[model samples]
Target: MNRFRQFMSGRYGFDQFSQGLVILSLVISLIGTLTRSNILITVSYIPFIYAIYRILSKDINKRMKENYQYTMFINTVKGKFLKGKRNVTGTKTHKYYTCPKCKTTIRVPRGKGKICITCPKCRTEFIKRT
Candidate 1:
């Protein structure tokens, strides 16, 4: 245990990106196994190997940056999905529109016909039927 700790002292170790890669590898391996595909089983090693490489890498800054980017990408995807969920849930009660100038989403109450909508972010006005 002590020797392993010493060996890993300068290594980047496990992180979110590494964990994701490992999970992806396992999922691919499972699918490959179910289908009995030799090619897919071989392909599953790619992520697992890269994850091991990342875990053993000594470049801390580069590993941190990679993790940061991966997290940011995940956050953006989650945000979009949540936004879409909200829009779907609010479809009957509220109307959703994107601001032309700032590209911000504006939510307003429905049934107000031919109203001029003002963007809260950019103050741009556009007429839309509700």
Candidate 2:
């Protein structure tokens, strides 16, 4: 146990990307098993193998960079989805709209019908009903 721990001491053992990879691999493996699909079984090993390689990798800097990139991409997509959901189910106190000129998001108080909106970033004027 001490030897194993020592071996893993400086390793890039886990990160969010690695965890995601593990989950994806497991899901693919399980689906392949359930459906008895040889192709999925083969596909599942790709992530599993890469994950194992990442865990055991000794190049700390490269691993950290890759992990950072993966997390940033995930966060970008997740943020957009969450932002869309928030826009769809806007709070009763405020309404959301996109600025037509600069495409910036504009939030205004609700129940103010037929209001003129000015883009704070681009200084473009538009009319909307809130």
Give all candidates' CA lDDT scores: 0.96, 0.92
lDDT digits (tens) for residues 1-130 of candidate 2 = 9999999998988888789899999999999999999999999999988998999998989999999999999999999999988888887788998998789999999998999999899999999998
| Model 1 C-alpha lDDT per residue in residues 8-86, reported as the tens digit of each score | 9999999999999999999999999999998999999999999999999999999999999999999999999999999
lDDT of 1 at 69: 100
**Clash counts for the predictions, in order:** 0, 0
Q: How many backbone overlaps does candidate 1 show?
A: 0
- Pairs of residues at least 3 apart in sequence or in different chains that clash in candidate 1: none
Candidate 2 error regions (>4 Å): 91-93
RMSD of 1: 1.4
lDDT for residue 118 in candidate 2, whole number 0-100: 92
